[model samples]
Target chain A: MITSIIINGILIGLIYALLAIGLTVIFGVMRIINMFHGEAVMLGMYAAFVLFDKFGISPYISVFLTAPIFFVLGSIIYKFLIDPIPAREREITSLIITLGISFIFATSAMYIWSADYRTVTLPFSQDVMVFIKTRIGYPALISSCMSAVMIVGFYLFMSKTYMGRAIRATELDKDTASVMGVNVKWISIATFGIGVVLAAMAGGILSPIFYIYPFVGSNFVIKAFTIVVLGGMGSVTGALVGGIILGVAEALASTFLEYSMKDIMAFILFLGILLFKPSGILGGRTRL
Target chain B: MFFKILSSVLFLLLLFSQVSYGAGTFKIGCPAPMTGPGANFGEKFKKAYTMAADEINAKGGVNGTKLELVFEDTQAKPALAVSSAKKLISSDNVIALLGGWSSGVAFAVAPVALDNKTPYLLEHPALDDITRKNNDYVFRLQPTTGMYSAALEDFILKVVYPKEKKKQLTVAYIYVDNAFGQGVAKYGIIPFFKKNKDKFNLVVSESYNENAMDYKPLLLKVKNAAPDIVVLTSYLTDGILLAKQIKEVGLQAKMFTGTGAGHSMQDIYEKSGKATEKYFSSGPWHGEIKDANWKKWRSAWEKKYKYVPGEHEVEGYVAIQVLAEALKGVKSSDVVKQREELKASLKALNMKTIFGTVKFDNFDGYTNQNKAYKMTAVAQWINGKLLQVWPKEAAEREPAY
Candidate 1:
């Protein structure tokens, strides 16, 4: 039972890491919280749902389509909404602007979808694979693997690719990167685009496992934010580790204690980490 | 001077028009969660209310006055409900109120209704205290949380245990942590189990916050407990998640049932796919009532809404019909006297509607609650359809289990 719980926790944690990685990356590069991150995830879910419903495309396959489409959408948002604010006021202004965007997106989705709960029920969605008394749904297993691949791919992109290095340099010091002829504006756009793509991809993969609704984004946004804070604000690896810790802690708490104490346990761990290791497990030093 | 005179004439005309419009219609304020977790209930309520009002108006309305519904979005929050109630009573000047989708919201709105002396007909919230508070102004159509599981309890005691030939069975409960959930467990399940302690053993009783994305850990705990029957209380989103996760975790129980709410919703079956097959839910409406009006209403509702009406829609539609019936007896000239008369009329109401005979009687420490009507009807998901399976008279199909 404990083994299954831990394994389930890690599987879910990987997805959580994928969800938060976008927020952390955006914050790392632009020094602004993308309040619309969750809504982007919701939109991705809807996009996947539509493709599944209309075109009979599987959500796992739609992830490939959703990523590129959202990449373009993210670049457009960065160009119009995030680019106008001056650097000095960008952080606070971008937060408010993104929040407004979040509301608009949510309201629009509700108007379009009529607040109904939608799910992409694939043939294997309910198929359970049991190994050593541990039951894992095909959707959960597949989505977790997708999340793991994306997280690893993101890490590789950050460390190995020149564009990723440019984004990292911009995160460290935009002025220095600009002086070094990195084109900080382009890096910021690419980083924002990547962040949006990651969030959308998470939503696409999660569509089968989670209900798709306009307000569903709110359910995951808080957790994503918590993961971002718990994982040293900008560190991709921190997000990964923090998500696992929180997930495992939650699983343990809910299993041992009452189920209602799961969130309380998560927040307690969050507060403890804040109090003791304010920089988080991998907080400040690892920017990427 | 000429332009000023024309403006004065237009202003006076507008004022008189507003007054005449008010005189020709009776506005009922509806406070519902139009945009939150409970938004689906609100949407159904809106549809039911609109349908009832349209039908009523088409037949020349109550006392030759058209029924006007003033909707206020409460978001299912207590603070928001209170404000909506106050706004409805004060600014909207709605003669009566309808629709409270959550217990907390109903509790908050009940006080405002009492304070303002407005007759509030609550369609959905099932907390027992809403009526037990001795507030005459607030009347509830739905059964209290405790009564929700009555039919399910009967099915378990009579059909399930006896048919399975089990002398004793272990039960586990997973409910949303709220007034409704707690009330069901405290006032309903606990007492029933205690009454039949020799036949039942409660192994696990757990509560989780609403709108939670995951229930794997909770289900794992339940799995460890290994109860024979698992009872749940949840709204739509969490209900669907619980069903799916219960299947994913491979938690095997002889019977899985829900005390209404999301478990009774069609969305759960559709969204959860085969996970909810054979699952039972106990609620007020099962769409299989043996009555012509019920058949007519159900057909019309499904035809218009493109989905079958559930307990929420039934309660919403009936609340309107009940209020309209009460309003028919209100012949007082004064506004205050009219409200008082409406309350009296509601207390005196003993009508046979499509749902059942709705009589707001005082019993079991409850005031102005429709205790005359049978509240619980058990429905099960059989072959992708929710079919009434309990209460032999109302049963559309036999219990699969």
Candidate 2:
């Protein structure tokens, strides 16, 4: 039972990390929390749903379509909404603007889809892998694997690519990077685009396991925020570690205590991190 | 300037024309959650209420007065419901109020209706206290949360228990933590177990917040307990997720049942696919009545909505029909006197609708409660369809268990 709980925790944790990475990336580049992050994920879920419902496409394949579309959407939103704000007030103004954007996204989705809970049930969605007593659903396993691969690919891109280095330089010191010919503005746009694509891909991965709805994004946003804070504000490795810790903690709480205590335990851990380690596990170090 | 003056005059004429049109109509205020989590139920209430109103008007209207339904979006929040109720009563001057979707919203709006002395016909919102508060204006068409599982208990005792090989079966409950879910556990499932203590042992009772994404840890706990029966209470989204997760976690039990709410929805079967097969749900029954009127109404509803009406939609339709029946004899110039007559008519209501025999009675500390309705039915999902399986006469199929 304990082993199963831990395995389930790890599986869910990886997905949580994928969700938080997008939020962290946006924050790292722009120093502004993208409140519309969850809504972007919601749009991706809907995109997957429409593709499946209309064209008989699987969410796994739909991710390819969703990623690029969301990248463009994110870049356009940044250009029109985020980039217009003065740099001094960008943090506060962008927060409010993105919050509004989130509302618009959610309400528009509701208007179009009518608040119905949609699901994509693949033939193998329910198939389970059993090793001794530990059982894992195929969708969860596949999503976790996809999340891990994306995280690794992102990590490699950050460390090895010239654009990735330029984005990191822009994150470190925008003025210095601008003087050094890094094109900070373009880097910021690219970073925001990449961030949104990650969020949308996470949504595509989750479409099979979770119910898709207009407000489904709200269910995950709080947890993603918690993970981003816990892992250190802008650290990719921190998000991965933080997601695992929180997931395990919640699983343990649900196993021993009441099931409802799982979320309470998560919040308690969040508070503990905020109080005891305000910088987070990897806070102050803006590692991709 | 002359065109502006003429347009202003026309606008004033149009406004007065609307006021004159209002004099020939009797309005019922409907406070429903039209755009929030409860919006699904709200949409159903809107459709059902409109259909009933249209039908009444098609038959030369109620007492030759056109029925006008004034709808206000409550968003299923108490604060919004109260405001909507106030607006409906004061501005629209509705003689009666109908359609409270959630219990929290109902609790807030019920008092406003009472204060205004308007008859409030509660279509859904199953908390028992809504009717038990001695609010003279409130009358409910759907069964209270406590009564939701009455038919399920009967099915279990008579059919499931007798067939079980074990001498003492174990039970587990996993429900959403809310008024409706807690009410079912407190007043329904727990009492049944306490009554049949010798035959059943409740191993665990777990409650989780609504719209939670993960149930694997929770289902794992239920799996470890290995209860013979698992009872659940949830809305549509959570219900589908729980069903899927329960299957994913491989929690084997003799039976799994849900007490109304999401489990009773057809979306569960469609969304969860094979995960929900043989799952039983107990609530106000619909879709399988033997009456010709019910058949006609069902067909009409399907033709209009492109889907079969569920328990909530049926309850909404019945509430309107009941209100229309009560409004039939009321003919008075005084608004206060008309409201009083409507209240009295509701108290004395005993009619047959497609849903069931509608009758309100005061019994067991409940005021203006519909105690005579015997329509709570348990249904099971079998072969991608929800079919009534209990109350032998009303059942379309035998219990799959």
Candidate 3:
């Protein structure tokens, strides 16, 4: 039981963190809510499906290609739809814009894919390894490893690059960062792009684990949003930690309680954390 | 100007000719999930139902009266299905009803058929409650989740599970959290497993959201448990998704099974590739059999639709055959008489179908008649082909998986 709980908790938490990372990054810099964040994930799955079905490209390799493409598409969307709104009025406008984008992407996904669930299967797809008393799946291990690498790469990119610092500054205070010549608007757009890239990467890695459909992210997005908020919006590390914690909690609850109570546990944890530490565990105190 | 006048006269004559066609015409209402999440199945159902109706009409119109197929898309929602059923009854004044690929929609609209006193022929929805209740009008071709599961238990115990069954084969059962899934798990798998507890171990039984994308943890838990067999019952996407993940994670068992005929679809193998090659599943619908009636239906279906029928299509087609048989036996377009005749005929009638004999017992809603399924078949995806692996009398090929 202990082995099962630990193994289940870690693997589930890793994937959860991978999915929520994008939402956190976008929330960090954009200030405007990207309601279509889940659509990005869904689109990424579609992209992976197309690449595999049409070009015979493995999802593992397609992530690198799809990520940049989705990132650019995200940037273009931000430019045309999200950027024009005034900073003071950006939140509401962007909400409507992203929601509209989400619907369009979902509908477009249906048109292209036809709502059939697809998967990318390869050799060694059913390989399992045993260590100690706990058994682990090879594909799950690989996805967690990939997710960890990408999360670290995102951390370094944010901490070690000039554009990264500008993005961070904008996230801190767009008006102040603009006064300091940080190009806050461009940084916001680029940040949105980066967020999409993360989502695409996660999608590519996780597609084999989940079915590819137009509304694939419909259920996960709400949880992603909840995780992002629980992580204290705008905190990358917070998102990662929050997602993992949520996943672990849900897994444990499912093991102990009825499976119906799993989602309820996640919300209860959120409310509990909010009561104890309103700003979140890693969400630094700030004036919103 | 003369040609135009003649064409107008011809068109008016055609319209006038059909105006008197309703005197002996029978109205059959179709409630399907045409435009929503389950649209593909619904569309297939519509095609099959229409094709069946055309065949019946071509055969002198069921006692010299034409059969009119009235269709309404339920959008796979309960509220929409209820309203659609109402519309079909009130507006179309349909003598009888057909089509319901979704269980929730069927359950929601079942009352409408009762209220309107129209015999509702349920095609594909497998919820146990549809026939379990005391209803004279509702008739279903496909058995409930319980029937499928019961047949599966018999198949596994008798055929799949070896004579010297291991006493400690840990089993993890995961299913979608819905009426179909709940019904299958609660009434089918659990009871059978409980009776055979000494033969195998029941490790864990869990339910997951149908729309969940990340199932790594669930897979991980199953992995750690080292279950010998994993029984899964989910919709198309999640079913395939679970199979793919199970393969990628290298989870292996003596057998992996599904409750219904969902795994028999081309998409399951097409999407998951060799991952599901060796899996054995039981479904009430399979085409690779040698029943004369099935052969006729197959030839006609191929010639008409140009694609081989899936399980859903077969069930849909058989449902039409049932409705046609009932309507033909009744010889009346009156809704009340049609309902009575359809119900009586369904109970007493027998269909030699692709899945062999389909006969209903009494109207017990929990299961189909007293004996739930008309027929159950065990099939396997061996070498990229769905082969009938059980009921040796109908067995076309040996199980390769």
Candidate 1's C-alpha runs over 4 A off are B1-14
Clashes of 2: 0
lDDT of 1 by residue, B174-291 (tens): 8889888988888888788879989998898888988676789999889888899999988888898889999899899999998889988889999988689999998776543888
Cα-based TM-score, every candidate: 0.97, 0.96, 0.84
When candidate 1 is compared with the true two-chain complex, its DockQ is 0.78
Off by over 4 Å in 2: B1-15, B333-337
After superposition on all C-alphas, the RMSD of every candidate to the true structure, in Å, is 1.7, 2.1, 5.1
Using Cα atoms, each model's DockQ against the true complex is 0.78, 0.75, 0.33
Q: B9-30 in candidate 3: lDDT tens per residue? A: 9999987776556455787888
lDDT of 1 by residue, A1-288 (tens): 899989988988998899999999999888889999999999999999999999999999998977888999899999899998998999899999999999899889999998888999998888999867799999999998989888998899999999889988998898999999999887888889888998888899899999988878888888998898898888999999988888888888889888888999879978887899887789866776
On TM-score, the leading prediction is: 1
Best candidate, DockQ: 1
Better of 1 and 3 by lDDT: 1
Lowest lDDT block of 10, candidate 3 chain B: B363-372
